[model samples]
Target: MPGFSKILIANRGEIACRIQRTAQALGYRTVAVFSDADADALHVHMADEAVHIGPAPVQQSYLNIPAIIDAARRTGADAIHPGYGFLSENPGFALACQHAGITFIGPSPEAIELMGSKRLSKIAMIAAGVPCILGYQGAEQDDVTLTREAERIGYPLMIKASAGGGGRGMRLVHTASDLLAQIRTARSEALHGFGSDELILEQALIDPRHVEVQLFGDQHGNLIYLGERDCSIQRRHQKVIEEAPCPVMTVELRQAMGEAALKAGRAVNYVGAGTVEFLLDARGQFYFLEMNTRLQVEHPVTELITGLDLVAWQLAVAEGQPLPLRQEQVQLNGHAMEVRLYAEDPARDFLPQTGRITAWEPATQSGVRIDHGLIEGQSISPFYDPLLGKLIAHGATREEARRKLLRAVQDSVLLGVQSNQRVLANLLDHPQFISGEFSTGFIPRNFADHSCLRPQVPSDAELAIAAALFYQASAQVHPASLAGWRNNASVPLHYRLGLEDQAWSVELNAMPGEVYRIQIASRSLELKIIECDGHWATLVIDGVRTRHAYRLEAGQLCLFTRPGSLRLTDRTQALVSSQVSISSGTLKAPMDGAIVDVLVSEGSVVSKGQLLVVLEAMKMEHPLKSGIDGVLKRLQVRVGDQVKNRQILLEVE
Candidate 1:
């Protein structure tokens, strides 16, 4: 049979680039679709042909089925590949592709509709003899009915959106008092995210391990399971780290779970790639969680261990092919691990960060692979998922893979935006992770120290080197007889710098031939510049040599080293202090987002730590609370207002 000659990827970011790479290797032309915000994005340039879809927001672009199909038709593409997130699992998109006579590179629309609803999928799982958690999946969604169902299921249950994944529209309620509010929030989020307000309830298992089995099927009814992946390392109910071949899995358990996963697949005549998730408890028993009907974000680890290209398999199956390998022929070798690098601050509750990437350097090694969609000057907007890319490492043993990944992360460089690099490094070194004895509570129970997330302060020697570099750069511009030679020779030239809410004062005396004697907080050191460039500098401090990547942007000095990156402001010329506090009664937006709802009104008395507003950014809802007990004196924002960073939204007095 003839395969597809041209394929169009209907997604953005790293996943889009990933699919194009495979399609190009298979001798197929590739087409890319992008929003206005992503006009110059990396994926757009990597494709054989590019088309503009719509504006920045997803509803106007990626989620617009008509725009995507029109782009494919204009480019003369014969197939469409929905790479994960946006409309990958939407049955409507699949059915529309079929109507347009375009081959959808995934399972049939029937399978998507059957497994898209968590409530319906659970019912099907039960019929297929798969174990499921005790819960309610009724149709009545009124407040009173949900409240009564919560009481029947008892406290500490889960409310999950029936139509979406990625932890969106999901909440854990610990008591009856908070049930109604949570249900409303979950329903609103579900409607906004998935266009469906339907939900299902499940018993919240304590500290359960998240394991999922990978399955693939073909048009000829050949289906097979490809082991499992452990995805329990999470924060805010989203996976942070993942690995293939669960650490605690034995041959017996693997076989049983594999069979159960196959049963679920066969139940829907599942075709293409899919994952069956389960919640593994302490007693070694597993219960069905949900099924993902598209390619997963962590598919790299599975591919690394199994020596297979999942995207290639996806394309072949879309062309009416049979399974390339039987169950007995499938083999799992070596170990692979992956970490998701996000554009967010790990120190301040992982708040999403938006800025321009000044520098981008990815790790390159034999066993390491970097899948990213970033340019040197790309802007990370708060309009989509915060995932920048993923880093994967493979080795013969799990320990080897862990060590290799640590080294790779250290060698990589990503400046300008705050990332989870430090947090990921610390987690890999933690005792629990190293020993492979941890649960879902690992982050909250063991890794609560926010100090690890903060950037380390420069040492006295490093400070002297920075002073020398700054003075040298200044002297070259003025061409003075002697750098910083003042009428009053006894006092040295003083400079001030600010770094992450802290200020430092430096006193420096310039010497001959680009040298300086500097003092910071009673510590003195001598420094000499070995080589000087505006972007990078090499210096010798008290006979110790070091080099650092540097950038000066808008009076802010950024230094990048192997340990980490730090940003400092030149505070010498400021008339007032740079660190200005918000007015006593003002509440400012933490980041750029749309105000979802305001929980309090003016003149209402609220206690400390009361939820005042809910802001939606980067596709997640964050609640802002009152820091002090006070009356809501003024409301500056409404339910549907768009806000910027540090924009005042309300006031309390």
Candidate 2:
């Protein structure tokens, strides 16, 4: 079989770049398709050829099957690689590629259609002798029928969209009263997310370990399983951390699960890369979840352990080749782990954050790999998934791998946008995780206090250094005043800075030879500047020398230290009027998104915590609630209105 001369990647970001790297290495010219927003994206520049698809929204760009196929046709590419998301699992996209005479590097269209619906997939799995959860996957999808089914299944059941993944369109109903509302919400999200409102109900498995097996197949009917990955460390039913060779998976259990996954794959004539997910209970029993018919986000950990390039295998299988290795021949070596670094705030219910990445620095070390699509000054839009990149580490043992990954995460520096880096580090360091005694509910159960997500306050020495740098920077702008110096020599230079929500007032007394005596609150300290350069400052505080990365932007100063990044607003020149608080009666949008629904109207009386509006952003719905008991005085926004961050949407009295 001959390899494709050119391969078009029908995705963006890190996964697209990842596939292009492997395809190009195998002598295949790579083509990239991008939206208007991604014209200057990394993947566009990395590919041998590029084409513009459409706009920023996924429906007009990445998810536009016709536009993607047109790009492949125009580029004369013989093959298309749908990297993980977007149209990766759409059977219609696969059929379109077949009609366009371009090879779709994944499972067959028949297999994808068979596994696309959770209900249908569960039926097929039962027929193949795979154990499935006890629930209702019937064809009756009406509200009455679903409500009855929920009652029959009892409380504590899950309402899952038949066509959904990544936690979207999923709701856990623990009571009778919440069933109907949750069903409606799930259906609405399902329609928006997967283009289908169909759903399924399952018995909520509490704190089960999410274990999935990576499988590969070819046209020749050969299939092999590539060990298993534990994806139980998750939030909102979405995976955050994944590790290969599950800690508790004995050799016997591994063989049993691997065979069952292979059985599931062969039942649907699965081809190329696919994953069979299962829910492993505490009693050692495992039940089939769903099959993902494409390469997964956590494939890198499996690749690292097996020492095989899964992308290369995907390409090879797409060329009508047989399995290169049999089941007995495949082997898993040392442990490997990967953590997804998303642009989200863990403290604020993990709300997705979008802004410019003013500073970006990744860990560079042997055995540690950083797969990302970030660049300094890049804008993180709210139009796509929040996943920025992945950080993976491999070692001879699990302990070594965890240690290396933790260190790498600590050393990483990302500024201007809130991230889950500190949260990840804390989770890894938790006693439960270190002992491998956690489950899908680990985050909510253990870290609900938000202690792990709290930001570290700067030390006194660091604060003194920041003040000294501020003084020096102020002096550089105006050379005539000798900055912060007074001829009277009796008064101290006063400066005010704000860090997060806390404000600090500092009085610095300039001394001879670039040294200063600084007083913050009641504490006094000494700091000496050894050197000053652009974004880098070397300071000596109390005879300790340290180098820090600093950036000044829009009346604010950011200091990047080993503990983490500190953003301080320079409020010295601002008037008291500028510090006014938001009006108590006004409710603002927390992030940029479109209004999905308005639950309340003007003149309506509402209590605290009453749902007022639903805003959809980053493909998830966020319900904005009334902060206090009051009457709705003004409803400023309606359904379908696009809102900006902190934009007022309603007013109460």
Candidate 3:
């Protein structure tokens, strides 16, 4: 049994919960470690034992090697499972675990270090006879050398950080004119983000499908590939939608890719779950992209098709077991699709959101599965990734899976915070996506006009429903006996509702038979509340009846309907406060984050669209740009200062 009994999961959120489930099912006790922010998280309560590592920040807790090692020691956990982020791919952390005599449920540190660098790994893969893209991996990092290599690799090549992944420190240079500038910028980002400025160049594939073959190995020197996944739909180089059995895959192509992936694993002597990613072009040619030395966030799609528990496999392999199945014994069946549910507003540049969960109802169906750790009253802070969970569906056919996933997305309800649910549904329903003819450029190209995720005003119909709910929840009005039984005219009640930057004036009049007439601008609506139990409501508006969910919290109305989740404020008879306006050239923190860099000082002349400050939040850096040509008037923040959302950082005048 590898002499390890209880396992400690050195992660949080969905992945931590996921690992705990598999470990406990395999007759192993599990320990959970968390930061201050996750004190009451679902994963913490689900563990057999829990420990506090540090504060909410990653560096002080999740990535703190000594703290994690101490937690494992304190809880007597002999094995540690790093769930695909933070220190999962870090070689130093794995080496530390080895020094502490703890089992790191992943590849060897030598393999992690070798694969962590794109340059070194490319050299290794090439030596192992794996097909790779033509690129530059020389040790000389001078601008002249990079520029010359860019010319040799041709225009439209990629400048990527050798030590970076997940879209950081990477750029696409389309012309020789922008090559040097892009190179310097990528270098600076890589130096700051990954502590290394080494860069690599690769010729960009215009519209290749991002596919990866999953490989598993054990202690007895065995390895196998478990099919491939299509990760074509992406935004900012981060995958959004993933599925098993790429629509464009052929049996011959799969075999070739599988063999190539096996070679990659054998080169590193890998001994755990790893992924070899590749770019597949239209001409049936493929090139190795990189290797992920840990389990992927999209591993569930692979599990769904192959009927295997990947986490279970990881546990067994860590316990010094042999390969579960050989190459010829593996089989894939049915079709599966998955979507990453995020706590972000699609209309507002995908800004991460933070708020308490007023309502949480996940859809349940025969073939639909949702993996999340959410509570109705839980507060989602801005301390980590905005990924709430994933919703995956499996069916006999692709269309069937697509239909079930779409319905699952629409039927599920999450309120009190913004999410990309509507945009995900729109992507699934797109004609190109339904036909499986999209590539990695699908989101940006199709959404150039912002038809789907643009900021939208609430329609009169939506407004009517919100007003009715607000009126009922106010508890100050009893209109059953005060109907329109006056002499000739009926008196009306007025209210003002605000959505985003738009507001409207509404008038409601109680009429006969408990019917209410709502008027806003030029249109009027006849609305009747059939039944409502505080949260879920059945309403009939304009001769149409439907059921939906709504909640009133902190003087705001949040609705979850077929259109999408919308939050509205009832500004009727409330005191107003002065605040900083966006048009005033005041740069405020978009979300809760620390100011990592202040590009300019006070009184510095700046032009519109100039990058002024870089705010680090949720494991990403956001360069705040100047909106007006003016001198910086007042600087309220400096590097390393943590600020809140909408808090003023600097002012320009």
RMSD of each: 2.5, 2.1, 2.2
How many collisions between residues are there in candidate 2?
Answer: 0
Among all windows of 10 consecutive residues in model 3, the one with the lowest summed lDDT is: 480-489
Alpha-carbon local distance difference test for all models: 0.87, 0.88, 0.89
Q: Which tens-of-lDDT digit does each residue in 321-375 have in candidate 2? A: 8888998889899999999998887767788988878887888988998888887
Whole-model lDDT, candidate 3? 0.89
User: What TM-scores do the predictions have?
Assistant: 0.94, 0.95, 0.96
- Candidate 2 Cα outliers beyond 4 Å, as residue runs: 454-459, 483-491, 561-564, 578-583
On lDDT, the candidate that comes out on top is 3
Write down the RMSD of candidate 1 (Cα, Å). 2.5
Candidate 1 stretches with Cα past 4 Å from truth are 454-465, 481-491, 561-563, 599-608, 628-636, 651-653
**What is candidate 3's CA lDDT for residue 304?**
92
For model 1, how does the per-residue alpha-carbon lDDT over 494-550 read when each residue is reduced to its tens digit? 888777677788898877666677889988887878887777788878778877777
What's the lDDT of the predicted structure labeled candidate 2?
0.88
